[model samples]
Target: MPLSTLNKEQLSAATAPIGNNLIIASAGTGKTSTIVGRIAHLLQTGIEPSKILLLTFTNKAAGEMLERVGRYFPAVVVNKIESGTFHAVSYRWLKQINKNVTLKQPTELKTLFRSIYEKRQFKRLNHDVEAFSSTYLYEQYNLYQNASLDGFDIWFIDKYPDHKPLIDIYMNIIDEYEDTKDRFGFVSFNDLLIKMRQSLLENRREMQEVLVDEYQDTNTLQSALIDSIQSNSLFCVGDYDQSIYAFNGANIQNIATFGKRYNDATVFTLSKNYRSTASILSLANRVIERNERIYPKKLEVTRVSKNYPPKLLIYKELFDQYQAIARNIKNSYTPSNDIAVIFRNNASADGVEASLRELGINCKRKGGNSFFEAKEVKFLLDVLSLIVNPKDMMAFIHIFEYGKGIGTAVAKEMFECFIHFGEGHLFTGMLSPRVFNLPKLNPTKNMQLGLFDDDTQIGSISRFAHLKLSEQIKSNPILKHPKLTDDGLIFFKNFYDFLKSIKNVKQPQTMIIKLINTPLYEGIVEMLSNQRAKLKSGEIDPDKK
Candidate 1:
């Protein structure tokens, strides 16, 4: 905890005059350590802990900082330092004042976009528009909002005149999305910063200092939010060379222009390498020096030099390269060696994995395949859950949608009914006499009916059970005798029979196999087969497989 223990540059940075300071912290340098020391120095200098804010780019980094502060300082210092990601801190601040804001998750946003697209009958492009909307459009929207631009559509059309038709369509989607969110009183992840900045401008909070980590990775909105919140006292630490998040709207110029933007900002460079040898540092410096617009800082290695240059291997083909790699691992590595073969993409590892297996080298993949995401595994689990607890609406919905007549809309309605009532409510509601006798409305007045027919009321259970109920209504003489279309006797009988058949099936594998052999699974298999055929015929990229 002593300030004297830090390197001269670190100690100076930790205890520097705290008026708009930027620390260019290189990789392998003690950036986090410097930030923690700075916080400790501030606390030791009689600064109110609550008036100091520490922001990171991730929850994990924030947590790590908190943990380190706790380890190095007293509990009082740890408790008073407000620390979190930018979005988290902004959201917490807004929530404290009772803002009626809802944060849309990525999945929720994608679903909303898909729903709007389907309803509007938009012409489909070959590219994944949902993905494009999320990544490119989302970033551009935030940038536009940050810059206070009101006419992004016109700007985009003017910029890309050749693609104006598609751009116009996209602009409509964005307009519809904005209108929808406004009507529902919803806010997105980026809206948190926009609103936070607005609130701060109206009524600035009493914060004496703001320290941001990974400043180079901040987007324009985040940078604006930081500027709004910090009252001439800012300490940002990041390396411009390490900025690689431009795809997500990270503006490297934020770091590059810090001094110019904050005219009185003091800048410091921390370029001492502590983790790597001199040879490695030299090689890295040589490679990065080629960049035309780099911050001029040379890393001085403090560790003992390995004295050996890095080795490079070349082969004629991917399989040959993988084979050589496998041979090298088999000959040079032991079971205890902590080695990794990193690849740019998961598909690139196929040849390496095969080669490694041929050489009998055991390796494990880092990520893939959560048990719940596997189709066969999830189906069986859903069935088991339904059998054990019939009131499990999620499980019931999944199983129900597998039937012939049940689609997502019908299943959602069933789920809603189940939520309002108790177990087996969906079945009872579907079979109710009230639903069967409901009068239909005009088509124009029944836009809310969704995929159902215009004559079908919202609660018309028989219409939902079209194929499933019609088959039973004709095939079973007993069901026909009940005149029970009004009572939903036929639908109830069919549902109960289906549930009962799967209830006592003790062997999950057998149940899974049986389910796979059904029409639903056959359809899925055929779709997959057609996709593979397309890939084989060069209509689709094999790498996408």
Candidate 2:
């Protein structure tokens, strides 16, 4: 909290005259500490607490910075500083003036986009060219809003020239969707910034200084919104190498252009590494240095040395990768619990957990999606569940409705027919075994399957009883049901073939791999590549007051 506690550069930046300032901070270089130091210096220099605005990508970050600031200041002083995420602070400013901001969840907005998309009846387009799928369009629309100030139509056509023929329909659908949102006063997180920027431009706010963290991840719109506050003093801290949100339209240039945008901006570098040894920093610098540098920076390690130089390991298979890591930790002199392996995605954790347990390592995973909650895994589980207990309506619904065109109503109808055919138990009549030596039944007329039903006590074991999934595709009476459309039939046939392939599988890991390859699964995956991410409070229904 004291000025002397900060390093020489940190102290200089914290106490420097603030017209506009950019702090280029690399990973684990005590950026948070410096931000807190800056806040303390502002307070010590008699800047109004009410006029200081702290913005972060997450409220948790803001809370953390303010909590540190609170160590040097009173509750009233810290609370009056107005710290939060861009969306959160913008929503607050808009709500304070009694705007009718109806913030809806991203899923709701996406659903609305989908409904409007379906109304245009784009089952097929040109015979010569491939058309963009609905989900792809939605993704593009979101990208356009976040990435730039240019027209969505222009951006879409420029990026995807093949989609030129389909642009009008897509734009029209978007226009209608926007009109609906306008009519209902529906607002998304992006909308909050746009509205806030517009409002501030018309009537400026009274903030003396704005401080932002992770400024490199901000896209063009966010940068524009930040400038619209009209505060002469700006403090932004970010590292370009740390930028990871490009998929969601993060612009690294925001950090690069900051000094140019504000000609009087003072630029400072926080290059001291307190967390990692020199070896790690050397490897990181080597890797990151290969990329084009927007802002030149070199990290200096506070830790003089490390016992081990970081090794870059490459394996042909994931099993080998996990197996190697697990073995390394298990055989180490240190306790297994003391060693940790971090991965980029939650899906990778599954294999690591399995490999560790194989070596008799007892470990508890902290924050990642478990195998069961996965969509593909859950779908396979539903199939197994329906097979075991035919009357499980939830499992039945999940399995039947998975095929295209089979909604809950049609699935309910399909269930009724299945129950009637199965004689109260699912697959009783359908899964009947095929007697290898006997003559096969006509593939077209499936009602003959009734003669071989397992419930028939009057006859000897029929040749057609106990059908495998592959056999059932052609001979199963369920295939002849009226409610099943052509698309539904195709989905089930593919589903059955996949099921039959994995029906005898003992290893769950193998089955899961096959589950993702199923035509039904592949279609869904192709349509929607990015799995639904866990929504933050900013993305979900924000306060509509």
Clash pairs (backbone) in predicted model 1: none
Q: List where candidate 1 sits over 4 angstroms from the true fold.
A: 98-104, 123-151, 166-168, 179-188, 333-337, 375-545
Cα error of candidate 2 at position 116, Å:
0.9
TM-score, per-candidate, Cα-based: 0.71, 0.67
Residue-level lDDT tens digits of model 2 in 364-453: 889966887766666777776665566654465566666777754456445555556566655554354232122222112222111122
On residues 1-545, what C-alpha lDDT tens digit does candidate 1 reach at each position?
A: 84656798888899998698999888888888899888888888889889989999898998887788787787876888788999999899989865666676554454444434333223333333322333455555555655443487775656556655466556665776676566545678877888888899898887889999999898777888987884648999998888898877788889989989997888888988898877788888998788765567889999884576778888889878889989989987456248789877777788888888998998887777698776555656776676565555446556555544443334434444433333334444333322332222222232221222422333333333555445433333222221134333433454555544555577767766665665545554454555665755558554544
C-alpha RMSD of each candidate structure in angstroms: 7.8, 15.7
Roughly what TM-score does model 1 have, to 2 decimal places? 0.71
Q: Report the C-alpha displacement of residue 213, candidate 1, in angstroms.
A: 1.3
Error of 1 at 91 (Å): 3.4
Q: Candidate 2 regions off by >4 Å?
A: 98-100, 124-128, 304-306, 335-337, 368-545
What's the distance in Å from true for residue 94, model 2? Answer: 2.8
Positional deviation of residue 545's Cα in model 2 after best superposition, in angstroms: 43
